[model samples]
Target: MSEQGQNRTMVEVHRVPPTPKASRSRMWTDLYSEHVDRAATSLGDAEHCPAITIAQLGSVAMIRLDLAAGTIQRTAEQIGYVAEPTYAFLLQVSGTASFSHYGQDSVLAPGDFTLCNNAVPYVYASDGPADLLMIRAGAGTIREHLPSPEQFCGRHLRADEGLSESAAQLCLGVCEQLASGLPEAVHNRVARNLLDAIATAFAISFDGLITASAVLTGRHARVRLFIEENLRDPDLSPGLIATRLKLSSRYLRMIFASGDETASAYVLRRRLEECARQMADPASAHLTITDIAFGWGFNSAPHFARSFRERFGQAPRVYRREKLGVGMPLRAVGAEAG
Candidate 1:
């Protein structure tokens, strides 16, 4: 939010003076958890030197990380606290890093970047020295303009072509403004414009993933219908679907390629979505959260809890209460456990 004509409050964090290297890893983890998203961090095969810069532009945060080889993993099981969802736009300013998110893997070259949804699990890793830029914004506002943001997140936006190149230039411009401490008085407008630009870039670059109505065939419809009917089957999977449909698992994958997630990920997401839906329904209010989860094909309670929390940004019990409120019965599932 390097707003034009307005000064920004630059926030910088560095290593505490006189600390042992053996404790550096823990220190880095603490700093990251405090400043950024909750995650497990390690320098990993490189020196412990790490630097962070945070510039506040109202609700938007511009962050810079200069570090050596390292990895940071954010998991659902550890996402205990409740918070609003966020969208992180990570740019690789220098060096390289590989990322895994939304059931897809992507390698980022310099000038490449990716968008991330904070309500889900993700892994960010660098093999060597790297400089990274991240712009974080509230997910609610961003989601308003783009329906079904899944098609955008976790896909690499290369800097060499199309709308992605335009986004890269805008991001670089923000960086320049921040570094120069320019009071341009355009922070709010810049943030909004940046989000609009990035959303457009992702939509245009990965348009095929969403416009399924144009290319969806009878077979595709059948696959989807089959998934809907068998959602309660814990063993339901791509291979099983392909076997029953007289198709190869490979072809199933190809058909689903028009969407963002793989076939398996799609099934899991659907299950979670359904679980959330039922938890809020008045008729299902009597059912325990676990009962709903198990009825929806979840086999492991712990895994379901973790996945639900990660997907919904809150624990199952918390979600149930939020949805049902005091209307939830004393004997209902959420009353006893989360």
Candidate 2:
């Protein structure tokens, strides 16, 4: 991905000294702590110098990494939301790399891909020289195109055939284009199209999987029904549901593995939906949005407001105002947990 070689387009290039192998791990650790309040480790020969190049396309980053046989890991202790949360999509270019995240593992060869969540612990390793294209996009930014990206992360995917092939081809072209330059508009549009292609591909793949298994469909339905019935329970969670349903938490999650979201995410969405329903109810206009949230098992007002906005595209106050008619204010409620 050097800026010099192939039919270079119109890119602006900057070069610096090669990063010293002995110091890179420390550098990455410091970077993680400073920005994301986490830690990362790079383990490889002291003489290995990684060649990394990065380009920004709108809010997403396209990076080319040439690595020696080594491992980069974020441990359980390093599991936390990034300063600006992102989902990392790694496309293997040449050689092989293995990625482990969300308790799943994928070994990638050329033209293979895997997705990783920045907020979770993960390991990326290679046995020898490897070339990769790493695409990092904000969590919310990704959801705009792929609503349940979790289903695709930490799993082996291909860029060689099927619907995903278009995404893989687009990404590879864009990565190469980064060395040369594309207009800002061109790159951004490329980013959007790539994401859209991935979402469509994943959706079709997921539908195929689910449609092939009636037992999975039934299990998922039962779990969801239980969640709906217990929406008002403050302690409702995947683990709790598993215990009540006599299923292992891992199995409970697996039932949702082929779906758009995990079991825990479904719980949050249900709670939010219930709260929205109450907020829009004429009789519940007497209650504040906070009250509605708490009634649906949310305990923290700030957390509720943030989650609501992310899901519904508006602040709770604004949503209520519009639902109740503009200029209308919520009536005060007694025992409001104020």
Candidate 3:
């Protein structure tokens, strides 16, 4: 896609207000079935219920089904109504739901989880009053990182086994956290990491069912190691770091923010410490102060000296002289003043 096309394809979610009764009636008559079909197709399931109320809170889609002591069953034939690719991360908050897909069938109680993809066809039913959280993201966004999007098209992934439990918990936590009003800066910083965590957790739970290798563990580990190794790189901003790591700069910021630090702050701290170490080293007694400062990636001598004093409670030259010995041979100050 062209950059403009890609930008247009990006998911930009807006907070939806609680559904009023009149609005609910109109939604049910006009949009509900179509909405359900879209959701079902993306998750590879046909969901049947008498009445379901949906609420939008930020990016989360919350649905409450009033089965009212009755039961509803959906068949694969009904699932064929859905046409688009999508993911359905369902969290059962109340009542019970029975799901059958991908040659597996299970009953989900409150607090349980079931994952669905709309790339294929499947079935689902519910009894009594049930509240569910359905997390949906564009198929394009998901498939970009998944290894086998086709295999996941029409399946229900149960979270009762393996890594699904952790993934389910993470999904719930993220939804709840997003629902709770987060500051704009912090929200942007944490959103993608939370999404990646949930996606990875889901992939692990489903084993190879979802085929999302890019969201797995190795990528995160490599990025972290890269950061640690290049701690002294002066140009190590989030965008540059992410480009080197082949990840979105937004995702990089989210990762660092999750660690309770901004990307720039993290790089700055690392560089500062590297300079401090070199300044405190005894072997560099022959080199002028500017050379020592510049060697550790400091671009400005005044800035480096000021930052050094603030961090170590002494000027860079004085700290170096005191720690590495002031009486050492003095190499002439050179033009390389960092």
Candidate 4:
């Protein structure tokens, strides 16, 4: 597909619709089915409707729900809606709410978070108007990075506490970043980091440490996040990142080795991708190629040109013109001249 076509496809995926009104007289009945499709049940006035916004990244989905006073339930039969077990990490963004799971119930004020396991059954209730951020992921995936996630399930982690607060903030931040729409490669790494953040948050809240495997997984995610945040620093290196994150240099290399590339290789790949994005963007048209290179941490012009071509199959200038709709026809002119 053409670049324009690709962009249109992305817009459709990241679209967040406004509050939808129900015209049907059986709006509440319709909501019952909707909540069922989402693996839940609702009890509220028929007039009350829900405002839901969804932002998806890979297997992780972030759902923002503005709901009226009601109770939502997940029954054993509803588990059939999904093939695999899944977990919903709910962050109560506003108003008062309560959660029940595994024979335990907890209340949450604004800023609190709790987990609801869909592998079994659970319930979430709100006293009045409620705003919630829900991060839903495959149960196996969460357990891969957070062994014993069952303990955290249905337990309220108050946001006022230190680690709990950090967890809430991280969930919000992850949703915001994912909603911005990122390239697929970068999106995968960021999604991993978000999962790690959630696992670590649970670990901290329980006054426990992540297992060895979980540590390695979490460290990789954290390092990826650090690299992305510091792409502008020309001095970004595994050693520098290890120092900043208080990890051993060899360990950092080992973490990235599990992927297709080494640490330095991954960094270079990301830098190249970032530079390409800038080149394709019309907003950066006024900047010189060399300036853009240096801005994304490429110190040497010749090195940047060579790497950019090696990765993208074209020179920076040509790619920019083709992408920004300026010099695409020049290729034919150049052929005629030849």
**Residue 178 displacement (Å), model 4:** 3.3
Residue-by-residue lDDT tens digits, candidate 4, 1-338:
11122322121122113334334213533553453234443434444555556666667777777777766655445554457767878889888987766544689887887876665556676868788888888877777777756556666778776567777787777666555545556665766787787777777776642444666666765676566557668999888998999988888888876668888887788778667755654445666777778888888888888888888887777777777776444432122111
Instruction: Give me the displacement of residue 275 in model 4, in angstroms.
Output: 61
Which candidate order results from sorting by TM-score in descending order? Answer: 1, 2, 4, 3
Q: Is candidate 1 or candidate 3 better by TM-score?
A: 1
1-338 in candidate 1: lDDT tens per residue? Answer: 22232355465545523356557778877877777878887775565477777776656788888877877777554555448778888889898998866655689988887987776666787889888888887867767655555455677888775687788788878877776674547777777787788778777876765565534443564576567557779999999999999998888988888658888888898788768766865557778888888888898888888888888898888887877786567666553335
Query: Could you tell which candidate, 1 or 4, scores higher by lDDT?
Result: 1
lDDT of 3 by residue, 204-266 (tens): 655743343445333543554455545546666678778898888777665554356676765
RMSD (Cα, Å) for all candidates, in order, is 13.6, 17.6, 25.5, 20.6
In model 3, which runs have C-alpha deviations exceeding 4 angstroms? 1-31, 38-84, 150-160, 183-191, 208-338
The Cα local distance difference test for each model comes to 0.74, 0.68, 0.51, 0.66
Q: Model 4, which residues run further than 4 Å from truth?
A: 1-40, 43-48, 80-82, 208-338
lDDT of 2 by residue, 209-303 (tens): 44556666556655664665566688998889999989998888789887788887888886786676557555567777777888888988888
User: How much is the lDDT of residue 333 in candidate 2?
Assistant: 27
- How much is the lDDT of residue 227 in candidate 1? 71
